[model samples]
Target: MEQEQQTICPWCMTEIVWDEEIGPEKHCPHCDNELSGYRTLQIGLDQDDQAEDEDEEDTSDEPEWDAGDEDESYGGNGSAWKDTDQGFRHTNRAWMAVEETLRRVVDEQEEAPECPSCREYMIEAGKQKLNVEPTVHGAVGRPLVQSPIETTLYVCPSCFNTSSILSDKDRERMLKALSPQD
Candidate 1:
């Protein structure tokens, strides 16, 4: 038998299939992002990611699996969901709760990499915004040009240099950088 082709949601990182029958503007059932088949992702299935997999195989523990869902074999405390210590839990939540939880989990787990302005790998940073004072006047009235300030800068492991995800200010900097080369 041929193996099924696998596609992943860029937003939720949910494993999906390229169902042409579903046509374009496909949204992730988990994230509901309008998609056009360009979402390429490599989902990490390391040991830390195994809880999601193990839960699938152990649906016997799921509440809705059996008629009574009372698996006498389980010595569990009859908890609704068992914590896998993976920061992920398997549980039967209401549809709304599931959607909200999935969104939170995906937003935290999915990798967001790209320069927002150039759409290139030129910069990297967290989503948080940080403001910093460029300088400070010392107590003796000596002017300090720089301080230990937050830049919302993330370091590129490759170059060991820090940069921010392209912002309006960074876009202007990119244009200035390009003008000299042009």
Candidate 2:
């Protein structure tokens, strides 16, 4: 059986099935980026040494696939979708969650937000729990002295550096927890 041709988009890094039906002037379906100058890429495909060098020259400063994701498929969640005659079906609920998370991550990647420390594109590492103590009240008034601070963590894919920022509601909650009761 012949395998379908596939390539990663230069702009969004989305894996796409290369089809001539869309013609050469086609744009990437995911990011709508132009595919005119971009070369078709496939995994395990043999190219001459010159072609390899050309490929490297064509691809520079591209958002590489995360080292963690390189070994795994479908965001390392083992999630897959099957197209039934009826429609489509997923393996499980966990797969659905993984799919959603992957979509969000890709969307964020397209935005190309730079990390403050490294000046490299930061990827969302998801939410993290932080134990914070009340500054004003301490343990004197409030029974629940220490609480969990939920914040979104963004990690630099290049440097492996990380930074977290809390949402407005989380900041307000932390302040309220620290405020002394009259």
Candidate 3:
């Protein structure tokens, strides 16, 4: 038996195993991105700078410590009013409260759908009620689609693309309505 070839998707970091009959996948299943090196970005430090850094050593003439340097404060030990001020404490507390609220909102969200364009996890914005007649071009007969369909809106943080999917309640209703009758 021939061993299957495996390739990792660069967009979503998903491991994909190619089927023998199908050969290799052209696009990633997870992120729907083309499996090509054109989209990959390479980043590294300059080789010459790295070599120079490795060869160089600390050669400062200044002493490591000076007993007379009492004016300097290393770790906020100086008499800076902002460091111990009540206003700063209040601001910090307000920021902490905002962070906690954001954390709670994130925790409450059950689904974070990946954006089709940028492969970034999308944030659920809110629900939108769309009222329009649904039509299918290839279907033999028009299936009954619920009017004023409710959909959950998603916003991609990276690309700022907006997309919507049928809400859970409406999706279930749609599936049941479209299913073949026994």
- Predicted model with the maximum TM-score: 3
Clashes of each: 0, 0, 0
**Number of clashing residue pairs, candidate 2:** 0
lDDT of 1 by residue, 1-182 (tens): 43455667776778876545554345776778765656465767576568778877877744665556565444344443343334565566687685575446435633435444444333334554454454433432432222322334544333445554445554564455444342
Q: How accurate is candidate 3 locally (lDDT)?
A: 0.75
Higher-lDDT candidate of 2 and 3: 3
Tell me the tens digit of each residue's lDDT in model 3 across 131-176. 9787753542554557788988988766889999888888887677
Better of 1 and 3 by lDDT: 3
Error of 1 at 12 (Å): 34
Greater-lDDT candidate between 1 and 2:
2
TM-score of each: 0.19, 0.30, 0.41
User: Which runs in model 1 stand beyond 4 Å of their true positions?
Assistant: 1-164
Clashing pairs in 3: none
Candidate 3's displacement at residue 36, Å, is 28
Instruction: For candidate 1, report its TM-score.
Output: 0.19
Best lDDT goes to which candidate? 3
For model 1, what is the alpha-carbon lDDT of residue 137? Answer: 38
TM-score for candidate 3, please give it: 0.41
